[model samples]
Each structure stands twice: as C-alpha cells, then as structure tokens.
Target chain A: MTDEQRLYSIWVYLQAEPLFWLTLTIGAYLVGDFCYRRSNLFPLFNPVALSIIIVSGVLLIFDIQYERYFEGAKFIHFLLGPATVSLAIPIYQKWALIKSNAMPIISAVLLGSVFAILITYLLALAFSLEREIVLSLLPRSVTAPIAMGISELIGGIPSLTAIITIITGIIGAAFGTFTLDLLRVKKMSARGFGIGLASHGIGTARAMSRDKTAGVFAAVAMGLSGVVTALIVPLIIFLLKI
Target chain B: MLESIFLIFLFQLVGEMIQKFFELTIPGPVIGLVLLLVALLLFGKYSTSVKTRLEKGLTTTAEYLLGHLPLLFVPIGVGVVMHISFLENRLLAVLFVIFSATVLSIGFTAFVMEKLQNLGNQNDG
Candidate 1:
C-alpha cells in the first residue's frame, strides 16, 4: 500500500481504539491541571470541569458517540465505587469529629433530601411542564443510577432522568464548589452535604477538594440520600395518587 | 500498600455478596465501606501492625485515586452535551430550577448544620 493509504489506515485504527478517548481524557486533564497550578486557583477553573469541556469538544468535532467514549472511559467509572468505599479511610481517621457531629449530619441529610425533592417538583410544575416530564425531573438530585430508577418507578422516563441527573452533577461540581465558598458556609458537614445532597457522586467528588473530612461527610450524604430518596419518593407519589 | 487496596476490594466483594444475599438496594461499595469501618473499629484501630498497613494502604489508594476523583465523573457529565436540543424549549425553566435548587439546598444544609452546631454548643456550655 502507498504511504497515504497506510496513514489513513492508522488514523482509522486510532479512532476505533479505546486508547483514543482514554488518552484524550488524561491529556486534557494534564493541560487542565497545568492551567490550574499556573493560575494558583482551584475555583477559577477546576481541572475536571475543564477537561470535560475539552473532551466533549473533541467528541463533537469528531462526531464520536458517548457509547464509544464510555467503552474506554468505563475504567475510570468503575473506580468511582472503589474510591467511594475508600472514603472509609478518611472517616476512620476522623472518627471523633464525625461521631460528635452525628446528629447534625442525619438532620442535614434528611432536610436536604426533602428540600431537593420538593423544590425540583415545584419548579417543574411552575414551568407548566407535562406530568411525565415532572415525574422525570423529580429525581434529578439523586445519584444518576438511583435517580433513574426512581424516575422509572414513578412513571417518568429513565433516559431523561439520567441526563437531568448528569446536568445536576456537572452543575454541582463546576458551579457548586465556587458557590459554596461564595456563601461562606463554615461547617464541613454542611458544605459537603450541601453539594452531596443536591448533586450525588459528582458532588461528593467535588467535595473532596475541600478536605478529606468534608469529602467523607459528603459521601455520607450521597449514600444515605440515595437510600432515603429511594424509600420515600415512591411513598410520596403513591400517597399523592399521581 | 497493595495489601490495603486488596482489603478495599475484598470488602467491596463481600459488600456485593451481602447486597445480593439480602437483596439490599444500597450499593455494594457502600456496604463494603461500612464493613471496613466496622472491621477497622474492631481490629485495625487498636492493632499496630493493622494500623500501619492500613495507613499505607489508605494513603497510596488516596494518592492514586482521590486526586483525580473528579475525572471519574467526566464521561457522564459530558453526556449532558448530547441532550441540548431536548432541553431547548424548557431550557429556561429547567436551568432556573437546577441552578436555584442546587444553590438553595447547599445554603440550607450549611445554615441548618451550623445552627445545630450552635445548639449543641449551648447545651455543652
């Protein structure tokens, strides 16, 4: 084959390979990290958020589907659970602080969970959106998987819930952290759970930037809120008879 | 360090087992975390060898994983780009709710938690 033909084949191979997206993700993050460090600002331009925008741009430019990107990216996704479980390390380290704050933690998660649900529903209704759309939007604050499950359980579309949850997660990670600082919240649990309760895993991931202890409580909120939302949402819907 | 990572996965596996056997809706990794916490409280915290090994594991796992925690969330976050059209007509309301609710919840959580902390402090003093 001619040299041009060989180069064309190689290009196709790169596109087909999962290495492509994986490398792109790492590379973009590297640039994001560099910029963050150079500027000496965490809130101004978060590396994760920057890298995502870069990767999304690349995918759009190349016309690559999310499925193909996920084929490589799932390795990173798989780690979310282990990383979540790894939170035990920090919790174990900070047991004293956590134990002392138990009452507040439980109270915050409960109140925040309730507020997340009611607010999402009321806002959707005020917009005059359809009932099915309302059902879909209700679970927007929970973790994506559980939120999608809750959506389906309450007669909402799962796919829509998944996307809504993702957007919420992005907002929490990108905007929530900066906003938290702007609000000047002092308590670690509040800052962490605020993001966690409203945003889920991504929020907890964002919470990690604050401090290990804060990240642990955020994880606490994320995990418990999942259970709480799962249990209560169906009950609420059933009672309302909607 | 390797030993600690192994322990995390071991706990995760058992957590998955417990989840399946009991039909728990809670995620396996979460269950695994509680199990690890329990084990640490009972066994690791008090024992020097266990503590050393665990600290090594925790730091290594954290260094390798935690620093890039946000990266794990990228693919899903990027997926939001695909549904822009669906959101167009309702974009104003949807964006308004998400932006406002998220801000409100965070503020509310912090406010309530701080108030509770003050209440506890008052009781103590």
Candidate 2:
C-alpha cells in the first residue's frame, strides 16, 4: 500500500471517535472534583489543576494527540466564550457598588498587573532565563485565552503560556485569601478585586466561595482586568523592548 | 415591561457594537454594563418593579454561573494537549512564573491595604 492509502486510513479512524476527548474531558472534570474533595488541602486539590494533570496523563498514556483530543473536547471549549460573556450580567447587577468603587478597582487592576508582570520579569531575569520564558511569564495573571493571545503576539510559546496560566489560577485559588488576611485586608471588595485581577477565573471562583459581594467584584475584576492586562502588557513590552 | 425589554435590546446592541469596534478587549455585556450604569446614574431613580425584575434576572444567572465556574477551565486545559513539547522544556520557568506572580499579587495587594489601615489607626491613636 502507498503512503496515500495509509493517510486515508488514519483520517478514517479519527473521524469515527469524535466524542472521545469530550468524554475524557468530562471524566477528568468529575475525577478532578472528586480528588479535590478528598484531598484536605484545597489548593493542591483544585479541580482545574487536577483535571488538567489527569487528562494530560491520560492523553500521554494513550498516545492521543491534542488536536484529536480537542476535536472531541471542543464542545467544552465552546462554552468558555459564552461563559465569559455571561459574566457581564453580574457586573450589571452590581452597578451601584461598582460605580462607587470604579476608580479604586481600576487602580487596583493596573497596579496589580504591573506588580505581577514586573516581579515575574525581574525575577526571571535574576534567574537568567531566556526572553521567551519571560514573555510567557508576563501574561500568567490573565485568563488563558487572552494570555495565549498576548504570549503569541510578543513571541512567547502558547503552550508555556497555558501551563503558567493554570498554575497562576490554581495558586490564586489556593492562597489568595490567606495572603490577604496576612496583610489584614478586611474589605471584601478590595480582596475580591485584587484576587480577580491577579488570578482571573480561578481567583474569581475562590472569591465567589467567600461571599456574594466577593463574587460580584470578582466577576467585574476578572472581566475588566482581562481587558486592562491584555492591552497594557503588550504595549509595555513593546516600549521596553523586553 | 416594555421599558425593560427595550433596555435589554439597547444594551445588547451597544454591547455588540463596542465589541466589534473598539475591540475593547472587554466582553460586550460588560460594555452594555457601563451603558447600564450610565443610565442608572443619569436617571438616578428607578421604579421598584423595574429594579426588582432586572436584579432578579441578573442575579439568577450569576448564581448559576458561580456554581460551575471551575468547569470552564476545561477548554484551556485542552491547550495542554497541543503544546506538550514546550511544556516539557520549560516546566520550572513556567512554574516559577505562576508561583511568583500569584504570591506577589496577593502579597502586594494585602500588604498595601494593611499599611494604609495601619496609618489610619495610628492617626486615630
């Protein structure tokens, strides 16, 4: 048989298993949640973190390609856009509180992004890492889609960006409030805003777990900070020529 | 009733237009949000029924979403499937970035507010 025939056979096999990764993705989600609930340590057991690790392991063990996995899992992926859009409803509902705190929230997101990017970049330089690593590191605080775009535009690897993004979210989920309390941040609004700005979705989840007020601020901050960081981080990188 | 429907339509249209044009990087609903906030501020007075309906509709959706927010990461998780090689080479550096940024943001925000609150306490003392 010629090479053409072999390629056709592989394509045929791929077409047959459209829902494979979808099942795996859902399985990973459920199992990850189970593991998180079982584990006493909330941070270590973060469902998002665990699911990614488990699914990656499963894919690797079975030698499944990402594109093929994504083909089946893309239904889950498709929801992210709408979910992100759905975040606006809360922001609208909380208009009065948000309006009162708009200036402060904006200030926090800007300061938080600068702090996140600068510390990551400076520390990476201190450790003598290459430029690509630094670029990928820069957008770790943003949500995955926005971070991926920022990383790609400034020449960072998207895969590295994805991993770092997850790590950021998990870390934010686990320790955000602990650190906030250590510093004695009593205001739920500020705490939520800071977490949402710094950690995106995971941070927002953690915030929501705290209170309705935290959740509202988290939704606003998560959405708003995405806009701020995506715009500002690239411009800064361009200007600094880093 | 008619006014509320009109509000949704107007807000949604403006939201989509902002998204299409400014690429504000913000979600359209958020843009609609700013518009809503502006109207609220400008009107400075909302009837009880209108407020109740809008708030009720918005809050219900928010509550539902808040429940499953963690599940949304599944898509980005799939991104890992695509870029395994890059993940292999730069695990530490990526880890460092995540750990440091997460810790730093939480630390910095908390620390600054603590200082301000302390200053306020000192003044009262």
Candidate 3:
C-alpha cells in the first residue's frame, strides 16, 4: 500500500478509540516535560502550555473536532479537582509562615483581587468591548472552577471565561517572573503572591518551579485570591453599579 | 500511597458535601483544604505518632500530585480550542486587556504587599 493509505489506516484505528486523547494528553505532557528539562527548565517551557499546543496541533492536523478529542481528555480534566485539593499540602507545610503573615497575606490578596478587577474593568471599557466580554473578563484572574461559577452569576459566558482565565494564566506565568524581576520586587512571598494573584493556577505552577518558599506563598496567594475574588467581585460590582 | 490518596479524596468528599449543603460558590477543593488543615492542626496538637504517619502519608501524596500540577491543567488549556470561533472577533482586544490587567495586578499586588509587610516589620521592631 502507498504511504497515503498507510497514514489513513493508522488514523482510522487510533481515532476510533476513546483512549486516544488521554494517551495524547499524557504523551504530550511527557514530551513537554522532556523539552522543559532539556531547556534547563526555561520559564516559558510550561508543561501545560506546551502540551496544549502539541495536543491541539495534533487534533487540528488530524481534522478532529474538539468535542471528539475531549472524550478522552476529560479524564485529565477531572483530575483538576484532586490536584486543586492537593494544594493543601504546600499550604500545610508552610502553615507556620502563613499564620505569622496572616494579616498581610489577607490584606494583600484582597487588594490584589480588587486591583485585578479594577484594571480589567478599565481596560475593557476603554476598548468598548461587549458587555458579555467585559463580564467574562472580570473573572479572568480567578481560578477556573470559581470563575466559571461567577461567570454565570454575572451574565458572562463560562466557557469564554475559562478561555480567558487560562490565557491569563499562561501569559502571567510566562511574563510574571520577568516582570517582577524588572520591577526589582525582591520579596519572595511577594513575588509568589503577585504571580498567583494575577494568573491563578498557571502562575502558581510557574512559581512552584522556582523555589519552595515561592511555591508555598504562591499556593496561599492563589487560594486566597480565589476566595477574595469570589466574594468581593459582586460586592464591588454592586457598590459601583458597574 | 493508597492510604494518602484515600485521605485526599476523603477531604474532597467532605468538601463536596459542605458545598452542596451550603450552596457555596467556593470550590469544593478549597473547602476540602480547610477541613484538611483543621484535621492536621488537631492531630498535630493532640497526637504525635498517628499524626506523624497520617501527615507523612498525606503530605507525600499531596506533594506528588501537586508536583505535576501543571499536567492537570492541560485539558482545560486545550479546551480553549473549543472557543476560538466565539473569541475570533474580539481576540485582539481580549488579549490586550488581559495582558495589561495581568501585569498591572501583579505589580500592584507586589507593591502593596511589600509596603504592608514592611509596616508590620516596623511595628514589631
């Protein structure tokens, strides 16, 4: 048989199985991890970002619809819940430091959430973007689970919010460290907190790659921002009547 | 490993129960975290041997999971593929706004945290 026929047969066999995307997801992540390690763990060599690019590129190349790919991908998606729960470990490990800095952490996260909303609102209005887009944009700094819920409450598209949130995370993770260094922000917790506050899960993941103290603080900051953003967004929106 | 994974899921289950009961907006995992923290605290304060083992088990499992935390987010990142059409129109504006807001928020968070922490230090001094 010709190469064309061989390619078609291989695609047909693999595409028929629901496990394909799951395999692809894990495989992509492994490849990404390998590249990241080989690259000396470059900040931009984020496994999530790389795997998404690789898997999505494959789906696009194969002409497979996202819904079909999602069949197997959902397994990894479901793990997000447990992984989120696992964050309690770092928080638990650094409980003493967090406890000591409780007041500063709470205050900084509160202000950070507001700052995120405030800037997002300003920029969204400046661009005269759609109200739906603006609403979705508001929760971009928060985690997926909370942002998705809040998106529905505030008349935004939850899926769109998820997209924006992830991109926000990816971008923040890529540039946040450099930005912090540029600003000469020498405080370890502050650096971690900034990343977490702005980018959520993706940023926290990046912080974890750097140092333990940074990772612990980023975890707390990400966790705190989730709560503060969930609670305060509505109150601020109500008070400002925005 | 099995024991630790069990503890993680156990807290998550309790978290889900509390979430449904309260109709809370908070993620179940975050609530689970609080429960786990409380348990850790009670155990750390009152018991030694049992606490050590449980803590050891849970921390190991949690560390392992969190260590590769980025892997868990890949599916969600890939889900972005589903929304390209909807976002295609305002893509530039959306990107610009998110980029600016992210930078500004990080800067502001770090600045405010530094000042507040220094204030706390000054008071202690």
**Which number leads on TM-score?**
3
Query: What is the DockQ (computed on Cα atoms) for candidate 2?
Result: 0.35
In candidate 3, what are the lDDT values of residues A43-132, reduced to their tens digit?
688677788899989988878888888777888777767777777777777778777788899899988999899899999999999888
Could you give candidate 1's per-residue lDDT for residues B14-120 as a string of tens digits? 99899889976677888898888887777753658667767777768865777678888777667777566676688777778787777777777767776886777
Off by over 4 Å in 1: A1-3, A36-44, A239-242, B48-51, B83-88, B122-125
TM-score of each: 0.90, 0.76, 0.92
State candidate 1's TM-score.
0.90
**lDDT, model 2:** 0.70
What order do candidates take by lDDT, descending? 3, 1, 2
Q: Which candidate has the top score in DockQ? A: 3
Query: Which parts of model 2 have CA positions greater than 4 angstroms off?
Result: A1-23, A152-163, A181-184, A234-241, B1-55, B113-125
Which is better, 2 or 3, measured by TM-score? Answer: 3
Give the alpha carbon lDDT tens digit for every residue of A146-186 in model 2: 78878888899776787778778878887787777777777
lDDT of each: 0.78, 0.70, 0.83
